[model samples]
Target chain A: MPKASAKKSAKPVEELSYEEALTELEGLVASLEDEQNPLEDSMRLFERGQALVAHCSALLESAQLKVQKLSGESLIPFEEESE
Target chain B: MQPTLFSSIHLTVSQLTLHIRKQLENDPTLQDVWVEGEISNLSRPASGHVYFTLKDKNASLRCMMWKPDAARLRVNLQDGMAIEAHGRITVYEPQGTYQLAVNLIQPKGEGALYQEFLRLKAMLESEGLFAPERKRPIHQLPNKIGIVTSQTGAALRDMLNTLRRRLPLAQVILAPSPVQGVEAPPALVKGIQLLNYQLPDVIIIARGGGSIEDLWAFNDERVVRAVAESKAPVICGVGHETDFTLCDFAADLRAPTPTAAAELATPITILDLSSDLLSARTRLTSLTLNLLAEQKAVISSFISRLKYISPERRIQSAYQHLDELSRRAFSALTHGIQIQISNVNGISKRLLSLNPEGILSRGYAIITRKDDHMVVSKVSQAFGKMKVRVSDGEFEVNRGLDTAAVIE
Candidate 1:
């Protein structure tokens, strides 16, 4: 059911890492492949899958690893090692 | 009676000490006894023999551990360290003092702790907390990965570098807590809760290589329960490859080292998922195109093969056949008319000989009255003036007698 995807909207697909995006994209691909599926839902999943593929590829091509630490409630940049 | 006074009455101090030493050495109970006391005045000389005073609050005994026996000491002995020494009690010959000739030494309270560790392990193990079925499989690829370890510890550095090199796309959140000491247990539990609330796909609780006491925090009940309660799969890497703790049992996966935890957390790297995504995309694209081509071919064949033979072509063919037939008909009629024309011209010569116009052209005469304007068939029909008519010329003669003269 597309309702399964309701939680995915909270975290933007673009913010997801390559693995996250790729996992979601794979699910979407499987859903889209079902010919008997509703066209409207299929189209939405197709669009998201396309975006995920692009996002995953872009992240793979980029060369940076981001690290953050939880402070109070928010994430702060952790750079303790550089000092 | 002769040797009586010196021999029978008393002996020298050396003989008395020698008899006492032999008596103590012959006693099975005093041969080897375990003496537990605080060590005081410990002395390890160049000869490598260890000499120490084993004392309780009441009294003290001189203890001597031989060089080879002291070399077997697993636990270091200091002046204040409480120890349990095992050896025989024998009197030294010159000083004639009875002391413990120590052969083995161990820490006083460590065995009890080890027993407690074993007891707890057995208790928890019976409850199925350490059952293999309870362990969740590690997520194949984790996006949000939480790390619980000391911030300044080398384990944290190692995990960070490993994650960076292997899979940069994984987002890491550090939950820093003391990984050692008495305070580490509750702190580590809190760290686990915090990461669990962060909704990470997976978590790694790890520490570098450590002694049993240093890593005892991992065996803490609270830490083990926290690991067991996690919704996300957890990887426990508490010590070196040879070391394992109760946390390793409660964890979903046990990694031998912190770097191994990192490796297990990031099962698929960016490069790996990238290639997989590309492959999926290629398959989807090809599949779509194939279906489209299939439909297009059906449509094309239907339109070309089936609809092609419909009325339009039929009318064109009909028109072509009609034109050909009409052209043949017109040519055949013209040919028949030309043949008839030649046949009539050949027959016309015979009919021409019988005609009077041809005979008159040779020579012929006829007379007619002028008033009637008709050719005279007989001379009697001539009026007062008769005209003679011939093929080439006409003459007038008087009455009927002029026929013959008119001709001359």
Candidate 2:
């Protein structure tokens, strides 16, 4: 758990991995949320945030619910009628 | 062959005893009774009837139970020992004496079955089957979920409904078993073993509330051992919230009810998570637009500096075009993530009217009187030849003298 931060510190927000996107996006959100920075800087960060979010969403969409149970063999889908 | 009753004013002893016996049999309250007391003066007659006096400190009652009822006695009864007896009260005909016709008897304190339950509990608990440190945390994103329970039980239905409502996408498969009676313990053990072979991310063993005997299967030593040894984390949702069993202790997690267990096992749906991404996308687009407007303001202010410095015009042009291209790309990306937003493009188009030059791009003209150089908002304000500004350049429009006055 402690190593998570050590690894994250080595990485930049723009080049974040899929698991780190949510945290980076949330941090960017908090930073930009006040509208304090000049428009150009905020805009640059916002585009980066968008790219990161899109990558994270793609990962989520790829996962599907996989169902299996013990039959005579180890684990098989429940829809198998012969069981 | 003894007696005939021929009485003018009174009944004989036998006739009176018969009347008492009939009264005792007719009373409904005495028909089926459960009495708790110490037994005394016990005797077994050759006829297979067991006779005993059931006595508390102050009172004693004669009890006689037939052989068939006596044969079913789960615990042996002896004189001067406390027992709970079930029987009906009846009066003997010849003696006119009332006695309890005993049907069932068990030791008064914690019957044999309950005693066995306590013994198993103590043994398992001493073996550290219930240690909290041994519990495994349930997996956060397990796709496959297994449940070991009777398929026909209400617990199964509740679990299914909860899983469907909270996260219909989570996969749940059942290993069916009987959750009650003497034969239930082994069935439950078999189900758990089968489920373990599959190694689901998590397993839930569930049953509805019942008496101690009904829940005995969950407390069975074999079932408890299986839960403790399984590679997958186990959740025991046996009986109601108040009900507790050894399985609950041995399993990795204990839930108050089956539905609560289901909710814990599944995570939120993908759609719910994607909505967050949608919101982030919106913020990104709006930020880009805000930056563009800010930079426009900054450049207009720097226009005065152009008199002192000759800026490199060629490089400046290329940079401006690159910024514009990036803006267009950002807008396209915004549209791709448009599932959560409706008519966002229309809003952006409306924002164009906020800038004076942008409205001209839509083929609208701004007219001003050349003499006063004041802008005209209404069409009626059009007087003599007016300077009308369209998108590209300026032009003069000639108006008739009565054009402004003709209406009024």
Name the candidate that leads on TM-score: 1
Q: After best superposition, candidate 1 residue B235: deviation in angstroms?
A: 1.6
Candidate 2 wrong stretches, greater than 4 Å: A1-68, A74-83, B1-110, B181-183, B197-199, B267-308, B311-408
Model 1 ranges with Cα > 4 A deviation: A1-24, A36-51, A72-74, B1-112, B348-408
Residue B19, candidate 1: Cα error in Å is: 22
User: Where does the lowest 10-residue lDDT sum fall in candidate 2 chain B?
Assistant: B1-10
For each prediction in turn, the share of the native Cα contacts (below 8 Å between chains A and B) that it retains comes to: 0.55, 0.55
Q: What is the C-alpha lDDT profile of model 1 across B40-99, one tens digit per residue?
A: 999989999999899999999998988999888767788898878889998889998998
How much does each candidate deviate at the interface, measured as C-alpha RMSD after superposition? Answer: 3.3, 4.7
DockQ of each: 0.39, 0.25
Task: Output the worst ten-in-a-row residue range by lDDT, candidate 1 chain B.
Answer: B399-408
Question: Which residue pairs clash within candidate 1?
Answer: B367-B376, B368-B376
Candidate 2 local lDDT, B183-232, one digit each (tens): 78888888887877766889999998775567778888898998898888
Provide the TM-score of the second chain in candidate 1: 0.60
Best by lDDT: 1
